[model samples]
Target: MTSSAANRRTSLSAFLLGALLLLLLGGAAAVWALNRFPQVAQLAGLQPPADALVPATQPRAVATVPIGPQPLTNAVPVDALPATEARVATLEARLARVENATSRAESSAGRADALLVAFAARRAIDRGVALGYLEPLLTERFGPTHPQAVATIVTSSRRPVRLDQLAADFAVLAPTLKAAPESDSLWQTMRRQMGDLVTIRRADQPSQRPIATYDRAVARLNSGQVDQALAEAMRLPGITAAPAWVGNARRYIAAHRALDQIESAALLAR
Candidate 1:
């Protein structure tokens, strides 16, 4: 067959088949719609047989109960539960506050302990010095025998505060209190003189200036005049700039040592 004639024959067959399928589908759709709508089914020539119209008849009644009160549960009381819960909550809150307070108290106590230990160490060093125990000051002076010095002067003596802490306090008080260099320096110089005076009691020759100051102090003290000794001490150079407490401690410790030295000397002389 020719190509154009074959194509025309195929198209005619497809068109006739499509029209037959459409007609069948339309008829099926109308029958489905009539069944779904009973009213329309009667108009579409559908009807029930005459014997199907009658219906069975009957009646029934439902029984009802009279009204009554009812209990919710046999569970524990609301008042009891709330009271217990409230007690627990209060106790927990109080515990939290106590824990916080305990932590603060622990911190404060730790600081206080450290300060006290440092002060004790300072006092120990001062006492050692007065008694001529060089071991405390010079234990680590020679070389690095250990990671930490066995006897650091600052830590060697236990006192009210560490040496560094004292230095810090001094730094603050000096500037804020308008403390004069002369005022503190005077005390410092007097303190050194006091040390020198103690050394004199030990028969150690210091500088000529210190020697002269010591001579005057000794003479005044020997004359049974406290004011005179102080007057002489104040006149010494560089004594005006020293802190009062440090100066006082220096003299006090030295004087105590001097008494010890004097007794030793007297015993030896005898």
Candidate 2:
């Protein structure tokens, strides 16, 4: 061949070989980028490999316990609780009974003490009445005040005089035995009359033996025989029927007896 035709054929062949090498290198780079980043590959409209995709894990199920009645641990038994309550009730009732009995006993003691105090007060009043009224009346009429007149009356009478004689002697002393004034206390008048009634009853005995006994006692008493007077006075109540004034007379006698007892006790104490 000629020289120009040979140069043109060599250049054309070199250009076609370089174009093939560039296309191969570009294909290898694209494959390496898709392996490193799956998101880039997906955005480029490419599907990811099976190894790059991860599966979601499933949740496990939990076991449940069945609910039932709980066992009694620290609670008291239902049967025993009622019995304990009944025992407590019985103890309370017994305590209440005891308290009531104690209250009644205290009330009884209070009433007894009150009665004794009232009795003592009555005795003191009776004693005062006897001393202040009866004794003075006796002394004024029968003994010291008119001793001569009493002596004349007793001497005129025979020993163991009859009831008629005794009535006469009382009649002679009628002026002294007059009723007390309306202004005076009834207690004073009653006490004064008690002495007179005793004197009359003592003299008006049915039997001569008692009459003699009374006359002798009066005679001794007028002569200051205190013990003999008390002895004689004590005997008169048994012989006579109880008059309306008997209670007053008995109270006077009891007062004197009590005084005698008190004096005796005092002397013994000394």
Candidate 3:
């Protein structure tokens, strides 16, 4: 054999030996890495060694406690709930009553204030102040054409009639006639006595005098003779002396005097 051919054969044999040794060392490292970290070996496309691979284990049975019937929770007594509800209802009713009473009191106070204001305005009208000053107030309280307003005007404009004297006369006459017994004759006698007393009282009564005087005064007032009207109003006897009628008579006289004063002032100014 030639020397060159002998050298080539020696090189080929050394390469084969080196490759075999490298393959053995790589296989050992792969097995070791799979044992330490199997996920890394899997990512690298390496299979686990038979000793490193383990079969899956069955799940262990869990120890369980027996579930007996649960204990009942304590509940509120049914009777106690109704009592609490009733107490709440009673408090609500009491609050409603208090609110109603407060409303009534407020309404009464408002009416009293209105009455006082109306009385003051009436006084001013009688004290020589113009009726225009009081008209608005009266209209607000009672409408312009209301019966109450008309009555107030009429009562304030005229002297009061003394009818109380007639009541006294009737009282005196009443005792003169007795209660009749249950007999036709007694009843007739009692009727006769009553009739006689009534006739006498009627004859003595001066009832028409006040009426006549009031009519005269009203006529004078209509005729624009306020002075004459006041004179006629003053002639109403016993009206100013009677406590029941005096207040109204005074109011009427004051109104007349106010008109007279205004007229006198106007004439003087002219």
Q: Highest TM-score among the candidates is held by which one?
A: 3
lDDT of 1 by residue, 1-270 (tens): 699999999999999999999999999998888878776866656766434656555566768775796666886787799899999999999999999999888776755543443344335543544213533323322223321333333332333222333334334443322222454577775676576565434357433354465456556555544345545555445445545634543443443343333223323321
TM-score of each: 0.24, 0.26, 0.33
* Best-to-worst lDDT order: 3, 1, 2
Task: In angstroms, give how far residue 216 of model 3 lies from its true place.
Answer: 14
lDDT (Cα, tens digit) per residue for candidate 2, span 1-270: 688888988888888888888888888888988888777788797985555576656687878776898777988898999999999999999999999999888776755543443344234443332222323332343344334433333332212222233234433433322334455687876775565555544545633233444565456445544455435534542323323123333333343444443333323321
**Regions of candidate 2 where Cα sits further than 4 Å from its true position:** 1-76, 129-270
1-270 per-residue lDDT for model 3 (tens digits): 699999999999999999999999998987888779977877776766555567768799999977997766786677899999999999999999999999888777756655654555445544434445455555454443243543454444343222233234323322221232334486676675565454433755533344455666556655545456556655554334333333434455454454344333323321
lDDT of 1: 0.50
Which 10 successive residues of model 1 have the least lDDT summed? 138-147
Best by lDDT: 3
| Candidate 3 lDDT score relative to the true structure | 0.54
User: What C-alpha RMSD separates each model from the true structure?
Assistant: 20.4, 23.3, 18.9
